[model samples]
Target: MPHLPDSVHVMTDDTRPHTATPTTEGVWSVRGTRITADRTPEGLRLRARAGAEGLSRIVLRWRLDTPEDARILGDAWERGYGDLQWRTLQPDRALPWYALITGGAFGGPTTGWGVRTRPGALCSWTVDESGIALWADVRSGSLPVLPGEREVDVATVVTAAGPTPFAAHEALCTAMSPDPLPAVGPLVGCNNWYYAYGRDFGPDAVLRDARTVVEYADGHPVRPYCVIDDGWTEGGGSAPGGPWDTGLPGVFDDMADLAARIAETGARPGLWFRPLLSRTETAAVRPGLLRDSGFPLDPSLDVALETVAEDVTRFRNWGYGLIKHDFSTYDVFGRFASHSPAELALPGWSLSDRSRTSAEILVRLYGTIAEAAGDAVVIGCNTVGHLSAGLVRVQRCGDDTSGRSWERTRRMGVNTLAFRLAQHDRFFTLDADCVPCTPRTDWRLNRRFLDLVARSGTALFVSVDPAARTDRTDADLAAAVRLALDGGTPGGVEPLDRLSTTAPRRWRSGAETLVHDWAEPWGAVPLAV
Candidate 1:
């Protein structure tokens, strides 16, 4: 039988915990707030009503029945949120979305617990030997829920047990994300960011990339993509902010024409932009449209949303088939996913509109982008995976893979792909950044990564520098691109050593088992650079 939560508590702005009193079979109340838990086959659907005393968190507690020495696996807040591996349970660690427990033996049977919602609140888990707790963070930045707010549709808590950790995790992911917008075709592509870093490049360079990927594709039915990342806009470079109205003055004039030219190379054109930021003033700027100063537009405002929608519409209109929208999560929250719950957001500031929670605001922002994108494939980067699941066709599941450092690729790319691979197609097509072919990094290490991504049947994007291309590199690139375009191996890939390492070296691809060496001559760098 499944274990239900034993108690529910609310944490208000005063830092006091309020235990909810049972009012009905599946309902409870605290002061003026009402909490309801509806049992469904998937899990328990939790909802709440806020009172005059605002709430910061709604916690659900369950007593543990498992062995004392169980290992746990949790998730991250977004892409670039690394350090995913099964470890000894940490009571205070914030595990986003779900947590899986094993009996401390390698390849042992596993049990998983997770949350399912549109994510009206940011849900996380904390586990100890005696009990486990799930935290539903409903705070608007650092502020609590004030008076006269709408009801919060918290999250559904689900559980599953399986013969293996992979099976259990896959089941949990399917339960959590019931509806996902899957990619239309194999997402084999080339992006310029890793190689070019979005500087000293223009339409000519972009076309060269398009032609190269097409050449590598060798006329596969699933046409590859050539994405112009971050440098095309005026006043944009490596660390690009927006004012995305026009292309760079002389270098990338005629955006529509460039898109057409990219298509002429027999590759679909994709573009990247930071939608919530701008370098110059625009119609989106108003008193309530900004969180502070300097251009992170408040997504809660209608005008700001309108401006974002307009930018997306413009990208689609420019004849691009794919749009990679990035960095809104950092812009909205003023930080990356590298924060603890206590430091999730900057303190003492709320959204312009206080009627809704932060999760609701982010959902609305993603929805606006999706609706505006029309037929174009939408890829979300630096966006919350749990919230953006059903909206985006693709999601960058890890932090950036580096061209300059093999350590970054091993730590960020291999770790994220190995751990988050279960979310492929269940949430969105998982993109573990790029396979960067550059002079700075070894081809030996990168080719292994390239092969794994292609065989995994996930979105495979390679960034090839002009100087790095050789006869051998070209041959390898061709094989990987073709395999990726053909939808990988028949049964898809599975990590064999996930329970033991962050970067699994053994994989089961179709009927074949393959092993890879991800280490370099000096071994992995001590830090994730």
Candidate 2:
């Protein structure tokens, strides 16, 4: 885990300055580091600087005429895009990857990579990758380097040459950013933290899992949603820095009567929180607004953005239609899974709000928890995929999926739905998590991960443990939640044995392609790092 010297890696830092000139179309430069390259309409416009300031990172190297068994896709430098690591370009090996705005380097948020060819064209880019021979990333780290060189608008690197991989991940998610309102339709749900992982539940086990998601949506018409995850408030002896307001006296004694008893079981409640932690022994935390993980808080401080927008306006005045929230880029960069936004050098630390830039204080703390999540439906979880892309509509992306392992739900839900299923609804609605259907896992591999997350149209949560209900059967999780809320199928997965497995057991959805042994009914399990 030492890795960093590829000339000071974190995606090529080399202590700034690599001089490049000759502008007009695509190259400009300065000394302490300043570079640019324009040619827009949505392709090349790479800028950088250090002279008038703004130069924390810039690493560019592109050469094409590609094709050598190309196959790479990226999205998820956080949460759990379940062991995502696909490759092909090894006549000596060189397949690097990168793409970050906040949570850079290793703590996740390397959101970029894609190069496919097998006739069905594709091209996507963003952060980190060292194969296909080096495209180091960091593009911009920590933040606030500005004074001159601009163009690092979310670390510029937008390429979208489509034909397939779902129109090049929906044109690299609409050239990476500005395209939120798709109203994220498709979230067949139920999420008691993979069978109560925060150790048990409440509010009558979260309204008996909202009457088990209204008896697994027996009123189908896409309603579902129960959520509640991360045990309902009050210190359960320290979790996500503990102590969130209201509910939990004797387990959610009344978070608005458990959202009016899960809206009298017609389902649709969701809650979760974690807004940047608190639990310094259950509340009143303010040791000069803690961070560096000592009870997390500091959302670049404004009393932690007025107490996380008054706990997301008291979970949208307690009528919740979904809030989720979770971890805030590991509680605002305290670091996550492996660490890398330049080894957490939060732009040479010295905060308490030095006037923005940790990607504008995480897009103003994810736009103050998406403006107190009014009208609910926020999601995010573990957060930050290019500043939670238009402030989240649902984007867990990957990492947790094992109500007790079918080899950790086929290495985090079939490798994050076969490699970030083209940012499922183009960025936000791609929740690649859940489908635990336990009994200690293995309903012939969780029914092929509930028939590939109900035909992989994305976001298909389902946790269910009830002590593995006598070896599963809520009518087979109500026909996999009625094929993930009404037979989903707008396909495009393809993998077909990724250059030899980082959990690619052959795939191809749109036109039918199959093969699975994800280590057969549970056998191997090693690849966690």
- Write out the backbone clash pairs for model 1: 80-399
Q: Write the per-residue lDDT of candidate 2 for residues 1-529, one digit (tens) a residue.
A: 1111122111123364353554443544545554554545544444344454434444444423234444444444455545465444333222212221212232222223332110000112322233222232322234434434333442344534454444444555666555664665677788877767876567777777778767867888778888777756655423555446676676677787778778888888877878777766223333454664447766767777788888788777878878887777766665674322223334434345433345556667777887888668888867656556667777787667787766767776677676666566655777777787667767667777777777766677788777676534677777777767864666535666653576777778788887877676346766663
What would the per-residue lDDT of candidate 1 be over residues 1-529, giving only the tens digit for each residue? 2455688888876377789887787787887778888887767888888888777888888887556778888888887445788888778888888899988332247878888736788888888877778888888777886537577888888877778889889988887888898568789999998888878998899999999999999989999999999889765554556667789998888999999999999999999998888766665643444432346778888989998999999989999989999888888887887633434677778877776778888999999999999989999999998999999999998988989898888888998888899899999999999999999999999999999999989999999999999999999999999999999988789999987888999999998999998988877778648
lDDT (C-alpha) at residue 271 in model 2: 79
Off by over 4 Å in 2: 1-52, 56-209, 212-255, 258-260, 263-269, 272-304, 316-322, 326-356, 363-382, 385-395, 398-415, 420-474, 478-496, 500-529
Give the per-residue Cα lDDT of candidate 2 at 418: 65
RMSD for each of the candidates: 2.3, 17.1
Name the candidate that leads on lDDT.
1
Which regions of candidate 1 fall more than 4 Å away from where they truly are?
A: 1-4, 14-16, 104-108, 147-149, 282-293, 339-343
TM-score against truth, every candidate? 0.96, 0.36
Overall lDDT per candidate, in order of appearance? 0.85, 0.58
Q: With candidate 1 superimposed using the best TM-score fit, by how many Å does residue 156's alpha carbon deviate from the native? A: 1.7
